[model samples]
Target: MTQRTPLHPVHLELGARMVDFGGWDMPLAYGSQIEEHHAVRRDAGMFDVSHMCVVDLHGAAVRDLLSRLLANDVGRLKVPGKALYSCMLREDGGVIDDLIAYFIEEGWFRLVVNAGTAVKDLEWIGRHAAQAGVKVAPRRDLAMIAVQGPNARARVVSQMPAVYQERVLALAPFFGVAGGELFVARTGYTGEDGFEVMLPAVQAPTFWLALKAAGVAPCGLGARDTLRLEAGMNLYGNDMDEGVGPLESGLGWTVVLDGERDFIGREALVEQKRRGGLRRLVGLVLEDRGVLRAHQRVLAGEAGEGEITSGGWSPTMERSIALARVPAGTGDRVQVDLRGRLVSARVVKPPFVRHGQVLVNV
Candidate 1:
């Protein structure tokens, strides 16, 4: 049987087009995908992201285990509630998963991983955690709601319990606020300001309805994908997978190799760096009519070939953009083979859009 999130009934009532996303039934869209995407860019939108996995690590060795387990250093998070983005890799230096680690305290840290990779991530963490005497526990009792948009934070705050509202109001970007049974993180896949709130599963409905009453449109995954792509963020499997490393995926900075401390994929990353980054992921903007899509062959002069990782029409910019991996020599002008026809596109740096404005010169 397929799995269901805590908000499944709510989505059904809201007339969402439900689809199976890695076993869990999820909403692809509520109605018009473009309109839902626009709602987030122009106003506020809430997404049912309860399918995401929440794992908690407790005990003295948590920090030590994470530092060795992740490509990024956990010691850098000096303050409580600070979050760090990092990639966990295999012994061969290939990515296991890219995740966010939150430092709540020395003995308590929380990690939010992709739903599809939850089981694998837990297994990976477990395999390494024992070496450092850390306890990795998955928090299945919670549900997550991602409220995104310019007004997302303010709208969510209005409905939070009054006492917790004050603490949430003080949160800075990338920080989390934990009050009572609620945990609000100042983080979002969309470029806009928002929070990923993890609360008791039973409390999700009330909060979901309250946000709706506060004018936050209920968005589905369709809007989420477009927004994040425009924001230049990478989706795990599409942007990079177990076969790819950080250097080519635009996540080199997340790897903190400052110390002699060995990380899982450090040797492979060092070798890749020494080899001069042979291939890389870049953003492309379609100049003509057509949607860019994953695995689409890209041609740049000669016989240079690349593949699009993620692509779609940007509801905010009213154009199409994508992330493509190409040979190191690939340049500005590239052609995408769409439906066996060549479509010209301009290659540019990512973050195609932010704050409701287009970022690249399409």
Candidate 2:
């Protein structure tokens, strides 16, 4: 049976067009996808991200266990409620999953991982936790909602309890705070200022309704995809997988190689760096009139060939944009083989838009 989130009934009531996403029944769109995308850029919008998995780790050895499991160092998270983005890798240096780790206190941490890879991630962490004497507990009773855009923070804060309102406003980017039954983080997937709130599953429907009443538009997966693509964020299955490492996937910054504290994929990454000549992930803007889509071949005349990992029409930019993997020395101009036609495209850095501003020329 296909899984459904706690807000499945709510989505159905709103007449959402539901689709199967990685084994979960999710809303593709409630109405116009373009409108929803614009609402996030111009105003405020919320997404039911309850499909994400939340796991809490507790034990005296929790920190030690994480030190060996993740590519990014968790030790840097000195302040409470601080979060770190990191990748879990296989022994061969292939990316297993990318996750966010929140440090609550010493010997206690929280991790939010991709829904599709939750089971495998749990098993992987469990195998290592047993030897380290750490306890891994999955928080299935919680629900997540991502409220994004410029007005998102103010709207969410208005719905918070009176006692927590001030604290929520004081939260800095990449930080979270837990009070009562709510954990609000100043983090988001879209390139906008917002909060990702985690609350009890039973409270999700009521909270969704409250946000809706507060004039926050309800956005679906379709808008979410377009927003993330415009933001230059990587999707797990599309951008990177067990076949690719972080270095080639435009995530080299997440890996820490300075110290002697070696992680699972350290050796392989070091060797790959020593060998050099790795393909790189880049942003592409279609100069010709056409839509870009994944699996399309990228043709760099002299540098070499590559493929588009994620591509689509950027609603914010009003243009087609994509994230492609190309040869390291690939120049600015390239051609995309779209449906047997060679169309010219410009290769630019990722992030076509951020904070409602167009970062790249259209």
Question: For this target, which candidate reaches the highest lDDT against the unseen true structure?
Answer: 2
**Per-candidate TM-score against the hidden true structure:** 0.98, 0.99
Error of 1 at 68 (Å): 0.9
Predict model 2's lDDT versus the native. 0.94
Candidate 2 total steric clashes:
0
Q: Give one digit per residue, the lDDT tens place, for model 2 in 1-362.
A: 79999999999999999999878999999999999999999999999999989999999999988999999999889999999999999989999999999998899999999989999999999999999999999999999999999999999999988999999999999999999768999988899999999999999999999999999999999999999999998999899998999999999999998989879999999999999999999999999988999999999989999999999999887879999999979999999999999999999998889999999988
Per-residue lDDT tens digits for candidate 1, residues 280-302, read 78999999997998889999776
Instruction: Give the root-mean-square deviation of each candidate in angstroms.
Output: 1.1, 0.7
Give the CA lDDT, 0 to 100, for residue 127 in model 2.
Answer: 96
Model 1 misses residue 155 by how many Å? Answer: 0.3
All models: lDDT?
A: 0.89, 0.94
